[model samples]
Target: MHWNWQQEDWPHFAYNASALRSAEDAFLKGGGIIVGILHHVDVEARQALAIELISQEAVDSSAIEGELLDRASVQSSLARQLGLSADRRKANAAEAGAAELMADLYRSYQAPLSDKLLFDWHAMLMNGRRDLADVGRYRTHADPMQIVSGPLQAPRVHFEAPPSDRVAAEMERFIEWFNATASDAARPLPAITRAGVAHLWFETIHPFEDGNGRLGRAIAEKALAQSLKAPTLTALAETIHRHRKDYYAALHRASQDNRIDDWLAWFADIVTAAQARTTARVRFLIEKTRMLDRLRDQLNPRQEKALLRMFAEGVDGFAGGLSAQNYRTITDAAPATATRDLAGLVEMGALVRSGELRYARYHLALSN
Candidate 1:
């Protein structure tokens, strides 16, 4: 028999509340701390973080659907949407469309969710695609839809969506439950916990012909935004993409058997993990800014450029930190000039020069 969560005995979906209490608490605490930390930052920092997170979310969300998009192009599209100037890379139609949809989600996640709005989002996702004929509409035929693996010659279906006749009705019920669960304290599902269940529920329904995974994540993003009452996308998509195997397993693990404790814990953990990553990134930005401010008088134009480059690239910016040749190339400075700049930075404690001549590397003087 096929597995289903739409059965009547399900979604009261019994699970040990106590099992989720700690993980749920941890996720909530982490999000609160993230929001609190973000409150003190200036508008510029917040905008930058928002752009980065939203771009990451968009790119990774598409990636989860097997549609690889250029990060630069997506950033460019998003920058145009937010009126921020970035690297100035041009975006193709798909990148522009994805970025536009992502930006819309960030901007209007506060708006009410509806069937029409979702259909619009679906069209936007396939904006430039020549492959999809159904762009925005729900599946009209009864053709069986299954998540599968292996060659088309011998495919293996991991999960099958509800039949076409049932899709519309299933969606109606899902939408009704979504509207009610958030406000009804009598419901066993807490509003916050409902986001995870919502994700599973929506994905299982798989209403649209294409873009269901991406749109389903968008639904999750909406749930998350509602819970936080914030305008930001927490970038959980990148985390999910990284651990996609476990992500799929977590969904399948929640079956008609009705135990969803593991799925709930996993969802909370992923959200908390996403928030933690954004927290660390924002903190790093703040610290980098603080450090640069303290070194304003100590750094020359070339040294400052080199520092900015490192900061922009983060971990992979410089393998063992900047080299004299790197500084020379980055600043377009002569070799002697690059050496002098490096020497000056070392003297000012902005960098530490390691190794003997010809083999030396420049590392940031920041404490490990």
Candidate 2:
């Protein structure tokens, strides 16, 4: 017999609560620290981080679907959604739609989950990509829906969702449980775990033809925001991106089997890791402010831009740390000017240069 959540006989689809106790505690502790950090950061820093985190969530979520979006474009769209100014070009339709819908979901964090909201999100996700065929409405055809890979002739079916006919009812049941979190009833699933459950359950339903994966993740984000009672960006997509294989493997496993303990555990860990990242981000901004104060008088605008790039992008900031060549690229300076700026920065101890002659590279000298 085939397996799926539709065939499961669990109690209200609730899994073992004992399994998540430690995870719940850890998430709460980390979440509280992040919330406090959110309150502590100045509005400018908070908004900047919010812009970056939300852009990550949008871009990374689409990336999980093998869709590469421009980070700058998404950030611009998010800024527009937040009613902030984005000097960058308005994002293309795909980025704009994702940014708009995600912003709506986050802003309306307190609104009850419903079919209309889901449909709207679907529309936003496919606004530009679909352009004409009316994709987000629903999968009207009764064709087979399977996630396949490799050549079409010898396709590997990872999993197949329930028939399109059954999607509506399945989604209704899921939404009921989701909205119930707001009430004072004895909820079967805890608020923290609900995000994971929603993620799994909705993905299983495979409600939309194109944006199920992205929208499912968005739903998880919404549940998370509601649970924490704050819209501080979680950037869960960053974790998902790092563990893309494991993420898909767990989802496929849960789709094939009714037992979801392992799946929920993986998602819980992702949430905890995301919280730690949020904390690190807040502290990073704090450090940058202090560091700039210490070195402000010692650096020029172009040099400062190059220095901040390292802090902003972290590992992806620059491969082998700051270099004369990289600094020139970052600051749009000539080689002679770049060399002079970098040498001056090293003299002021703002950066530490290493390597020999032409091979010399530089890194942040942010040590005591």
Candidate 3:
């Protein structure tokens, strides 16, 4: 079932071209909306910061174990990147850790790097964490690497040491080809196609002792970045994480049969979808910012901070709404001051009182 990967497998699919153009158009339009939203928040400077953090975080998460990094770490890293105090330091750390890994991955392909270079990247991705660290430079000699599972759990042996030096030679040849083919401008390839080739070729080489899947993805992103000549703003890793089962299946299908048209199509579709998803998220965040602005205009500084905190954290920040107790907790106000603030918010139509006095909860008066 092994299909030899060749250039001819790429079909003249006009539809793919149209789809990519449409996706790019939509992305640009969405960018405008993102800008509008940022300006609305009076934080337009934050947009670039946000996009960079998001891109780096995405790359890091993909190269490492998905969901292994916690939310607090992600937030703290983002906060630091944004030059804000990270209330969630743990989340920021996770995101910062991921960004560093992604940066290292991008830097690795300056020249034709070695398998040891990939090993070091994998080590850094898994360093100080639980899942994938110890197997960094080491090679699995006794145990064979199994890429596919279920009935198709085919075991493949990779080289660890000397004597059978053909593996290293083959790997070097592959790396040379990868570096040369990706950079050649005369026969320019689509970013999606390059990503597919990078993934398949890296997996085929199986250069590392472990973390091949992670490294393969990182290499794919590197190729994509090279093709696009811009930092990837889309969350392709998150999209892959969501479709992990299908992702593995697609890779398996590609590996077993070399009709890479389907693989390329799948990769392109994922990229398109990832762009659409991120665009939608940016739009939603923009809308949320508008709502926050409207609410802030009518509230005092302390009340505004309380409202923003609630919006950012949702129900976790305050119990249900700005009750006297909730206000006190959120603004560090005394009980009487908290009561006055709640009453002021209610009078200003920012907070609506629900139920009787004893059981009342103040909720934001959101408009449709």
* lDDT of each residue in 1-368, candidate 1, tens digit only: 44765566654666677776776677567678777877777888788878877888889999987889998789878988978877778888778888988888888876767788888888888887777656677787668878889999999888888877887788888887776655332343543477788888888888878888888888888777766667755768988998898998888777545667778888888877777777777666676767798998878788899989878875334787677888888999998898888898888877787897888988776653
CA lDDT scores, all candidates in order:
0.78, 0.79, 0.58
- Where does the lowest 10-residue lDDT sum fall in candidate 3? 157-166
Which candidate gets the maximum TM-score versus the true structure?
2
After superposition, the stretches of candidate 2 with alpha carbons farther than 4 Å from their true spots are: 6-14, 131-136, 182-188, 331-340, 343-349, 352-360, 365-368
Task: Mark the 10 consecutive residues where model 1 has the least summed lDDT.
Answer: 183-192
Could you give me the TM-score of model 1 versus the true structure? 0.87
- Which regions of candidate 1 deviate over 4 angstroms? 6-12, 83-89, 183-192, 315-329, 332-340, 346-368
Clashing pairs in 1: none
* Clash counts for the predictions, in order: 0, 0, 11
lDDT of 2 by residue, 62-92 (tens): 8998888898998988898899988777688
What TM-score should be assigned to candidate 2? 0.90
Cα lDDT, model 3, residue 126: 55
Order of candidates by TM-score, top first?
2, 1, 3
- lDDT (Cα, tens digit) per residue for candidate 3, span 202-244: 6655655555676777777666656555444556776777777
Please give the lDDT score for candidate 1. Answer: 0.78
